[model samples]
Target: MISEATQAVITHYERRHEFRGDVFGAQPYANYGYWARPDLTLEQASEALTDLVAASAGLGQGDKVLDVGCGYGAGAVKFVKRYDVDAVTGIDVTPVRIASGQDYIAEHSVADRITLQEGDATAMSFGDESFHKVVSVECAFHFDTREAFLKEAARVLVPGGTLALTDIIPRRGVDPSAYLTGETTNQSQVCLDMPANAYDADVYADLLRSTGFEAVRIESLLEWTRIPFADALARVAAASEGERAEQISRMATRIRQLIELGEDYVLVTARRS
Candidate 1:
């Protein structure tokens, strides 16, 4: 039972998936990846970000993991192969992403270890205490109300299980409420869709605690993720031509604007209490 807001997000992704694929490549990741090194390629940086999130979640062999907003199942497949996780269940609202993820899983020969389904994150169907850990990479901000997804994560995670994700939040002194009222300028549609209450890290931590999580840790990855990603986009825009290049240039400009506006890209981790 996807809510209308969630459906709108699905539609947004479906419409932009092709353009995103062109920009991010065929590797099945849609994220502002952690650029660990200045020379890393986009795919490499994306994998690095996935590894960072997995490490933050303390993934272990035989762990059952759930990936919310798992785009194209790349993170799920990586978790299985890299950490030897017993199984990974990935859920995303966009049907096209699920279909592509199925193909990716089949190609990787990990069909038994990874499952991708079209489902709403804020209202998942999994039973309580269903997973050992939950991880989302760079997509949680798109959840209708990130707090709702946090509650769902708490419900599905085993007691003491971990949750880790990367998200975008407004820095102190910025009013996320303005986003709700359409007062913010130059914001991408996706940013505009983020619930106002999710804009601040302190509020985010409080929401997590209230939703049954503890020991929350939020680290800004602005330098590693957003800055590098914008740099890469600028390089791409310069090297490429035509509409794709124009799109890349626009995205680069948007990222720069976000940076100036004090938008923070953060990695947050917590445990179900």
Candidate 2:
């Protein structure tokens, strides 16, 4: 059963789905694109972020992968095509995204290699050791409790299987609750639903270790992710008009607020021990 918090998150995304294609480009990615270079378009940068996560997970040929919180199965399809992964099973709680992902999978002609289903990440249905790699991109913070999802990821992966993800973590000396309860714009308010246990880099690494993962590595990707994305959003807002422009402007503001709040955009990798 979906918790109230998870349902709220789903509702937020449901609303987002209406205009995500207009704002996030034609593809189905709902992530902060990794701006490897200044001139890359949003679609290219978004694909780059997915590639970064796949590389971090050490995805290999014939690997069976599980993507938790896979938004519209874009990353999963990318994994199968770009990384030569044998297959990818993507699970998400949002129904509309899953429906869209199914269409995306069919359109990409990878329906045989990818599966997108609506399901909870914190409690998965996969058997133990069912996958070789587990990945989540920018969606862990909304998982009700990221720690619980980590444990579940560990449970489903084969021994020594890798888990890689990008997440937002509060910087040292920052109080998450302050941001949660403070005044927020519409775009910012949607993200304030982050769980209490979402901790700093140090605590995050320790949490991974305690959750049956080892060789934990956490690297800040703020410069490549949120910073560039925010700049791009501002440009979009400036070039556009009407409600769409206002929405993009608010999103840019929210991204800036996160940066000012000392929130670190990080890429984390670990292996099941």
Index of the highest-lDDT prediction: 2
Give me candidate 1's TM-score against the actual structure.
0.93
C-alpha local distance difference test of each model: 0.85, 0.88
lDDT of 1 by residue, 1-273 (tens): 666666667777787776774667768888889998999888888989999999999998989999998888989999998899999999988899999999999999999999899888888899999999999988788787788889999999999999999998888778665444443223225424556345678888889999999999999999999999999989988998897788789879877876786688999999999
lDDT of 2 by residue, 89-114 (tens): 99999899999999999999999999
Models 1 onward score TM values of: 0.93, 0.96
Q: Candidate 2 — which residues are off by over 4 angstroms?
A: 182-191
Show pairs that collide, candidate 1. Answer: none
> Worst 10-residue stretch by lDDT in candidate 2?
183-192
Model 2 misses residue 25 by how many Å? Answer: 2.3
Residue-pair clash count for candidate 1: 0
